[model samples]
Target: MGDFRRSRLSSTPVVGRVVEWKKTHGWIEPECTIDHPEMAKHQGHIFVHGEDLVPKWRNLVAGAMVEFFLYYDGQGLGAEECTSRKVLRVTLPWKHAKEMFGESGEKLADFEQQTHVTIRAYQWCQPDGNNSDLPFLLFEIWGRPQAVVESIGALAARREQDGNAAEDTLCVNLLLPESRMWKVDLMQLQHYCSLEVSSSITITDPMPCRTLTIQAPLPHFRSSLHALIAQAACVGNLW
Candidate 1:
């Protein structure tokens, strides 16, 4: 009888929306009662604690969708191991040399320079053609200020004229549990950022490896680009 009761009360993963969230605790409203009818007693409310959320820094925003399991914690129904279904907007910090002509290449006085990117959790097929359960973050750099656009264009033009084709690529080194390098075309970057330019550059396929060194035309630019990728990884919980 005890086992039966437990089975009846506990539920499989269910979809719900966060109705209210405080820093410590919150309430979620289950979308349906197909599996757990007891939810009706609490008016479709499921208790969720901040500790139960995955990627802990990301607190559930009100009205955001979530997937969780229902279990009776003696006192009442609660959620456990909750996963949020919201896209994350992350800011990638970038700092360049204050004076490019300087020998030491001093960094800009303001360290707060940044651009915004959107990241969403996705399931991607591995080279082995198997769909891994691990969450892959798909991020796009969508925010390009006029200054940034001009800077990138100048760097690309300078690198292109040098005749080293590799220097014209933007290298994104993902420092996750498994490190990987993704090389994107400088021209593609301009295009994606809505810069008016024509180019015959083709996108490079993602190169997965245990370790790789990130390269760029200039040292300061490489450092800034590295920081930007690191920020994205941190926000996506891939670090």
Candidate 2:
């Protein structure tokens, strides 16, 4: 079972044009202040760091392109974490990998695989519920606790209200916005599978080009021993 209490730290920052700006409290909005000359006419949405969300960060102006960091920390690998299955363990050119996984191509190959997975990284937050739009770090994962992803999708598919898309890509979908329920459900699914899950991560991106890297207590992940097999099964019918 995956234990989110272990305190793992990771982060990723994306540069994009800010589309809106708002400052409810004393937060500085990045959407209003940060400027991205690279995209003077082109438009793109910045991936807001889930952890950092200060009142000041909200000062950003709409249409201002800025690079906001996404960091994950505080969570650690618990005793009940997901067990790893088979890992492809491929090595490719950094430039080519970056084309697909962004400048931080460290774990590029892991991201391309169409596997069910979820990444647990540190998120910045103030003492209160407030945080900045920038994250301190970032991490990528392709498959994990395969059982968790499979089970959750299955449960959601059973429900009439749940759509087929939700069932097909529950794990991938959750990556955009990691949630507590999904995290808890991942652990629960592990128990049901009776399999030991582990993680295997690699760093391939160069520092000079992309200075984004996470420092953590855990060793650099390679390939996992365990693999998510066909046991879990699909969640719902085909769309």
Candidate 3:
């Protein structure tokens, strides 16, 4: 019982080995290079040569592998090389994701049980660059809870009226920063059966063009709640 939209585009996965460390153009940090076959000849796929190289953002030096999953919509002149515009969907190995979960490892299982909330992965372009050393990718956490969602809406309204008061009030902040690079929207779904937290990042100069959605069940909401509470508890040294 899933609702899907007809899409005009398609996606594919691509992986390229790092060849060199590229420059950030005074815009982005932790930049590097890849020997992607498609990028070599495509007009849209530009390259950073000798003068354009930056030695500072060379954390992932030559030989570190790079992998990205992109949606390819047929367009541009690289039809021979790759006819599609790269959709900005990136994925890292599961091991990498596990490490990013921090100390919430055991707590994650409890969280999943209490709230049917789900966390999704996403990627976006680097706008200001090295202002943050984090990846453009992020994880989104969201869930479905009818009563809680409606109630929180009102709560947020009240907070807005209270001059947005409080230095340390347990305010139900909808948007929480997982890190400097990613932001999550905590919302309850219509049915309250579960919760869904999806993560995505924008690509290209302006941003990504596709829309994203997450579906969940009631049990998922419980799991999500458990995780959220555990996170707060950990931060408060409750564990």
Best by TM-score: 1
lDDT of 2 at 198: 24
* TM of each candidate vs. truth: 0.35, 0.18, 0.20
Between candidates 1 and 3, the lDDT winner: 1
Over 1-239, each residue of candidate 3 has an lDDT whose tens digit, in order, gives 11123122214323333344444311111122433444344433422223222232223334332222322222211111111111111122334445544433444444433433333344343466533334333433333333223222222212122454442122222223224112223352324323333355323323232222222332443344344433331120101
Q: Order of candidates by lDDT, top first?
A: 1, 3, 2
Better candidate by TM-score, 1 or 2: 1
* Cα distance off (Å), candidate 3, residue 113: 1.4
RMSD of each: 17.1, 20.5, 18.4
Candidate 3 root-mean-square deviation in Å: 18.4
Question: Which should have the higher TM-score, number 1 or number 3?
Answer: 1
Q: Rate the local accuracy (lDDT) of all candidates.
A: 0.43, 0.27, 0.29
Model 1 C-alpha lDDT versus the unseen true structure? 0.43
| Steric clashes per prediction | 0, 67, 42
Instruction: Arrange candidates, best TM-score first.
Output: 1, 3, 2
**Model 1 lowest lDDT segment of ten:** 89-98
For residues 180-205, could you state the per-residue lDDT of candidate 1 as single tens digits? 22432334333232222112211122
